[model samples]
Target: MAEKLTDSEGREDLVYIKTEDGSYRGWRVDLLIDNLSSKMEEKILLCSSCKGMLRDACFYEGDLKCGVCIPEGVAWQPVKMNREIVSDKMISCPVKKRGCEWSDTVSTVMHHLEKCEFFPVLCPLGCVCLDGERKGKVMKLERKLIPKHQRDSCPLRELVCEFCMNTVKGCEMNPHLEICEHFPLLCPNRCVIEGEEGTRQVKRRDVSVHLANECPLQKVECPYWIYGCREEMERKEMNLHEREFLHIHHRLSITDMKQKQIQMSKDNKLLEEKLDTATERIVLVEKNFESKSRELLTFKQNQIETSKQTIDKLEIATKKIAFLQNENESKIKELSKVKHMEDKLDTANIKIENLEKQISKKDSELKSIIEVLYSHISLATGQLEWKIKGVKQKIENKESSYGDPFYVGLYKCQGNIEWNYDNTGKVVVAICIVKGAYDDKLHWPIIYKYTFILLCHINSYYNYEITKQVTKEDLEKYPNSLKRPTEMRNDGLGTRSLISNTEILEAKYCKEDSITLLIKIELLPAL
Candidate 1:
């Protein structure tokens, strides 16, 4: 057979491939150049019929089946290499186009490529991150520079946020942190407590706790203070102090409101008495004026016969009429004065109505506060049961994979469970704080932080417990900090389970193919 010389395109990026009927051909640099070995080419590829290497296509068999495999007739199936042909022949490095000068054998070329600083490979993090077609995505880099390329330089490198607990891509870290509400911030309320007492810088997330529970100088009004009670104190002592003086405040409010109402009633009665007297006096004077007018009319009729008598009587009647008018004018002035008092009484009545509304509002609030205080007292004394049930069923749904969490509970301290979040078959449990209606009972964002204890309940006191502190950052994320909240936080605070599948499978932790976990949230006392 004749030798086929160099490639027609004159490209150096080529490899050799043996075609059927015993002829050599050229291929591209996409695959390994040393896929076949001259020392034992048959080991790389052999015929199924004759156990020979694939040759020329002119003596072709159907498909890739070699004509020589059957020697003369037809071939059924294509053949494969009997075994791998380990190459040792010399070849230039594949990165020759990139100004690499070192040459080596086929087997060792891979080693050089692996170590070459200039040799390009796909970016380790596969970041196609740039403008146009590559906006914060994957790309390619050098082999030796992968460490630096994938560290902070990689656009897709996972970066832990400095301000918050979230993990984001390096390229997005700055923008994300700019808007991350949970990012640590200096307390804006710091200026309020400054110089007075117990003032200092506080992280933004912790500001709620600091103002609500920590800073002793932070003044808080008594819940009943709006109702005429004037007690003021720090937030830490608000509950206990208010608890002590609540009844006194309520009594004072009630008494003051009742007194104001009684005084208003008396004033109205007195004003009415004066107005009626003025009215009666004006009516009597009016009647007397009418009688005098009638008498004057009668005298005028009698004096019509004599001119002099008529003149005298007319003068007297005119004087008397004028006098009666003056008396009526005085009585009318008194009536006008009574009318002014009645206007004032109307204003007073309006004020009394407003006061009654306020009293009603305060009364409703006080009742709620009492109910909450009782409940809180029961909880503190360990009289109320704060445990969760039906955990196994909640976690049993296989659809609850990583990143998705399920919540159980209608209000504050809701339990959240995510099964196999880490692909380790370990369930993650979280406690969520939803805004509740017990505003008068609990401080905003739950200033009394909680310690969540999750128990497998092996027997009684000896069961295993996974404990986590409900942090200020967690609270601030979904805080109903203003007072009563109407919604829960979007995310729950929790950890991947410390106990694994082995523990959950054990009878000590699991019973009846189900597990019952005892969960409790204890308030961390004020510091």
Candidate 2:
């Protein structure tokens, strides 16, 4: 039977889907096997657990199970009959709806896809000339249409320049001709110079320079045009015109110079008359200056007598100012002493404010210390007892109970009572390593030994003491459990099955649904 497959769009039973290898796309199996064939007895194999189609890639022969379903430990095996059936079954082409009238077995379909005309392909030159988001992107055209795309629309398609006959890309042809030195161009003037017999073609880049200097037909003015000749001619004919009119141009230049000389003589006479008038004005100014000088001398003599009288009075006033300055200096010194005392008073106030801040900080630290003392009881030096309530209830509810984090010297830790932490059917006690305030000063990875004690409510002799030792080797082996904690706490290290549910009631370790845990930490020398 021929089965029909449809894509997401459900249009024409064919759509292009690109695979990683850029070869055959989606596998649409319209499998039709002959019932009379000997190999038709086999059926498709599937995973027993996931029910996924199984292939050779997932077949695990060592444990007789599918690799994809191995986590569930489901036993399955690939059947030889399934591979035989697949290799012999006839499947229609992937692009059958795209006018590809081809069909083959699964074994030869991969090879047939390479030559299929209806198979979709990408532009081979997209990476070379396409820009931005289109770089290296797929073209999604049939295999037969690739040639037309490359020839018509591809920017990298090679083209021959009509002017220079040079090879260039289609997109770059226009810009190339703009700067192409060998490109041919017609002369604007269309001049015909003697002894040169060729098309009046000029290169695009050199057109301006040729018109200015090399083009014989370019319009130019005569050399004597400034002297009223007013003649324009082609560049090639300029020499002949200049030779023929040499005598006439020289005559015109001589007559102009003679006229200029006559005008200069009249200008010289006018300047001499102006100089005589200026000399007469200077004589009148000197006479007035002498008269003013005599008057100024009389006024200066009178001012000198008046200055002497004013100087005597100023000398007497200067002596009185000197006495007043001495009195002002003494008053300034006294004012400075008062200002200095005021400055000392301000300095004392600043010191008093600073002392008050220090006292407040000390008081906060003392309050925290008092809280720590009330939170837990201490049996001896370096030994702390944390009272954890609701221990029995937490065990019955299968919940873990933890005491508040406390510091033992430089190390911070918490006491935990976990129910069946390791599936041991018993209550376990653990100590968590918390990030401490003094971790920076302490040696790391931390090296220490701690004694965890489960105190008996009835007698001290029945108490359970478990010692956990941490060394450099232990930190290296289990760094996450024993290293300097980077977060709030590290994984807990403790004893498993400190007391079973039955044994806990018999031993009387728990009292009134509460338990007391004592921890003694000992610091070791750093290695």
Candidate 3:
């Protein structure tokens, strides 16, 4: 039917046709339809029950119905909504070389690339200048801005300092302002005014003047300076000095007041004008008072008349109030009933809360019991990690083998242990029995099997231990592990757990830039 109603005539190469074999076939639609179905009338199919527009309509039980409202055993074949294929070629993002992961049709590629995270964005700052390694230059457009990381706070952008008149990079601008000599700096003296600290902002260059000369703490001449008081002190100190010399200060104040009086006499005309102004205000106030008195008398007469009327109203209102009071009493009775219900509700709520707490407590107890059981089960499988962590902490804290050397022999035989790393960064722990360490108390040819354990401080599960079974004959024969000394001299207790440096560096055993490891030197139990 599409071919019968075909619009393409000259573009035969672009047209596609499907056969009974159903093999894959497609072509670019070189021509689009123009003025299709000109003679046909338009009719819209809607769902019978819901009134929704339906794509395909069919007759069901003698009534036209949509797919959604179709009766049982009724079906319809939908005419395909036709769309012209614009292009078969797919275009990848231009930033594919730079690492954008989008590939779509040419029409959609640009839209996807616009919002892609890896899409390259030029600085909105417009200037190509940069501060770091790319100094005064810009990289390729494909180099994407890290979205929020660089745009708002572009460190490479140039900024000028308001003070000192120097150009600085935005990254260094704050530090430059902090240390700029001409920058406005706050006074550090913290002058107190009415129990609050007062700060005066001044240029950093003038901070010394502000602190030493112009500050409130700076010394000043006394108020009685011309009166032969040779005291120069701080404002607070000058106040104290004036109090101590109150008699002299009073005499100076009296003379100052006499001088002020002389100055005041020259302003006699000004004082006369002020007196006239006060007299006019007095006359106005007296006139206002007379008017207010007349108004008050009339107000009192009206209040007496209103009070007589209010008495009659009050008697009638009293009866209504009594009726309202009775209604309020009835309401109070109902409120009491509600309060009783509320009390019952509160009691039920308290009981529910208690039961919830009890349920939560039982749940927690059950969970803890299950955990304990699991822990017991794990212990049977030789998971002694918890105990091992405690033991390792004791060794790391020097609490395990402090005063006495860790005994590594039968019958209180002692040995010293110290840690050191080899040239390859392998953690090498050297265990040795020093010369004459419990030698006088022991007989010659001492034989003891020693297991050197290096416990990982991170957790107790990782144990790097080596056990060496020593015979009286083998002790004299070996080079590293302890030897039966003839004169009770020193012997090295061999290295164990030769882990690679890369593994050791990243291992959880490394703590505080140094590895915390446990070394246990227990005298092997005798057979």
lDDT of each: 0.57, 0.68, 0.53
Estimate the TM-score of every prediction.
0.27, 0.42, 0.23
Count steric clashes of candidate 1: 18
**lDDT score for residue 319 of model 3:** 100
User: For residues 144-237, what per-residue lDDT tens digits would candidate 3 score against the true structure?
Assistant: 4654435556666677798888998877888898889899766666554455565666788898877666677676888788765678887657
Model 3 weakest lDDT span, ten residues long:
379-388
In order of listing, the candidates' clash counts read 18, 0, 0
Q: Please, what are the lDDT tens digits per residue for candidate 1 over residues 1-527? A: 22222222334333334334553332222334444545355323433343333332222433233343334454443232221232344456555565667665544654676688766567866678466433564565656678887875887799888767789998898889767766655444444453556436666567788777667667888777667777787666877886788779779889989999999999999999999999999999999999999999999977775887778899999999999999998999899999999999999999999999999999999887777664555334111123433446545553332212222122254556676565777867655555545444554444333333434556666566665554667555644432345555434556676566556667666666555555555554322
- List candidate 2 stretches off by more than 4 Å: 1-88, 91-104, 107-120, 126-153, 157-169, 175-182, 191-196, 262-310, 321-527
Over 4 Å off, model 1:
1-90, 97-99, 106-115, 132-137, 162-172, 175-182, 189-201, 207-527
In candidate 1 the C-alpha lDDT for residue 345 amounts to: 100
lDDT of 2 by residue, 1-527 (tens): 12233432445452222333343222323333333244223214334443322232134544222344455545544556555645666767767767888877766877887889887666777524244333455545678888998899777789998777889997898899877888877888875556788658877887899899989888988877767788899988999997999898898788777888899988998989999999999999999999999999999999999999999999999999999999999999999999999999999999999999999999889767755653342311255688877765666677887777776655687877778556667877777889877665555665567788878888899897788777666667767876789888887776676667666655367777767878777656555
Deviation in Å, model 2, residue 77 alpha carbon: 21
